[model samples]
Target: MPVLLTKIEGKGNGIKTVLPNMSDVARSLSRPPTYPTKFFGCELGAQTSFDEKNDRYIVNGAHDAPKLRELLDVFIDKFVLCKACDNPETDLTITKTEEILRDCKACGERTGVDMRHKLTTFIIKNPPKNPKKSKVKKATADGATTPNGDADEDAGGDSDDELTLRIKAEAAELTADAAIAKEDWSADTSPEAVKARMKAVEASMASVSLAPAGGDDDSDEDGDSPFAHLGHWIEENREESAVEIYKKAEEFGIAKKHNTMTIIAQTLFTENVLTEIPKYAPLFAKMVTSEKHQKSLLGGLERLVGVLHPDLTPAIPKILMAFYQTDILEEEVITQWGTHVSKKYVDREISKKVRKASEPFLKWLEEADDSEEED
Candidate 1:
């Protein structure tokens, strides 16, 4: 239902229905766009194309916006919206026997996926990863106070109801995706959003390691460094969150090293690190509190930013935005750090570029604060 706009590309038999709002809709459904796109293809008997890099989903033939939207509603009804409570907060869990179950958060009900549906086959093969910790965190936060002054066990609220409506309304937007600029600070902490972010980081890591070793990139082979060995641990432990990774580094004596922050900055966000930041903010509470650590943090960040393609410089803004949102990266700290340039962690030129890259986001944050004061 998310801003259900479609663009038709090409002519004759080669035409396709490109859902511009595909990613937005998937966010509403709490499922990946591939699931719904593949569902549509199976339902319509048409081939589907997925361009993950651009977040584009295309199905063969020209399908009317209303028709596809209707299909999306059906998909949501069966797979997304909880049956018992009619809520959107649910997790698809697969049992050892491979039975697919919908674990409803709102009503504590267990509903099985329709085994007869063709989508079941795909669902069975690609079981959606359960985001349990984030869910528990959200549930606790959403809990209302009881008359006894204890938090309610049943975490139902008007906020959830409002969220359900907002998702549908935003999806129906003909122009924008959602009011995220104002909301991401809070909403980015949700279970589904966190999972989506991890998946996105995994997708982006491919491009991060693409550039060669000449100007600003690391020259040593991935086989050379102790950090590379730590990175291997990250690859092997796909299910572990960043906090776990940081602890693992401690267990291996990597966290105490003077170079630990630098290594972590390189290896952290490569696997669900941003999604883990809010969950592990307490672990990093003192990270930038001191002048010495702040310098090290900025140095690590510079090294991490050095190898990425220049086109991705815009990411500096969003990275800073997330840090500011989570209160992990202090505004005063980042603003001061951005003004001074040093090559302590990375090449001299790379240090200058990363700071330059951070300037726009810092300026935006300053203007935002000024506007808030005026209001």
Candidate 2:
């Protein structure tokens, strides 16, 4: 996140609404009536040129208009230059100049101007750029190639359709797996067969991996693969015997990712991990109006732990506490929670509430580390 503070010097032409505080430039350009000018007696009320073809107002003579240039020298002694790159050659024309707004011309650094000083930081989050759309031979109704010479229909739709189909099929199989796993106790099947069948189903599902294939092997591409360990675990624990899959996940680090972890934890609670309290605990302590997802996630977590650790009673609170402090959970999980909370609930609660709630768990983790060192 980079904070840019710029001083508003002079009034810019009001017609170009997007111009950042180039008002001083405009004031300098306007004549005092006694001064001589070619375009005489034309009282400029924000002079703007209309691009009829594009249907947009463009600033053509705002910056270096002859009258404006003279005023700039008289009134404005100095202009605000970008601190990151001290280039005085800044075209304050808001609408037309795409290059300046998109990125810095001098240093090639991305820049945005915020009028105020509060930490309105801009972080550059670049998405993975995929291949551009290739033009195919689009057959017109008359069986002739279109003017653009590109097939408009079924070009992009084909890939999207394929992805949708894959997701739907995967969801259906998962549903079936859940039903089978739940009823394995009453079903007429050997435990080994049940396990084997489940494994096969899981393998088939796993084959439809989400990662884009045939890309350059970029090691620096550090990303969390969304192949849910829970999906794999569900397949692993098809047997009626042993511990439930959820419990094992808790024991292991399955729901370590914070956002997913929070959901899992919430799911566990909803499944009555706390039989002591029939009504679910108030999740999103900072957020007054709770998110339904927080409840669902807690239920999932409870079920996971309950299934895995049926025999040994789980330290539900401790596990929840542990999860809050986990870097994986805090980094991955809380970011999502923050996003959901901010979007659905009050935006203010996201930063303050999440940070406050997570701190206890973080502090507890530090103490645990200290104890281990002492031991």
**Top candidate when judged by TM-score against the true structure:** 1
lDDT tens per residue, model 1, 1-68: 45678888889999999988888778656577888988999889999989977889999999998898
**lDDT of each candidate versus the true structure:** 0.58, 0.31
| Alpha-carbon shift of residue 111 in model 2 (angstroms) | 11
Clashing pairs in 1: 2-171, 3-171, 3-172
lDDT, candidate 2, 54-116, per-residue tens:
433234233444554453343212222333675432212122332223222223334444423
RMSD for each of the candidates: 22.7, 24.4
lDDT of 1: 0.58
lDDT of 1 at 53: 74
Per-candidate count of clashing residue pairs (backbone under 3 Å): 3, 32
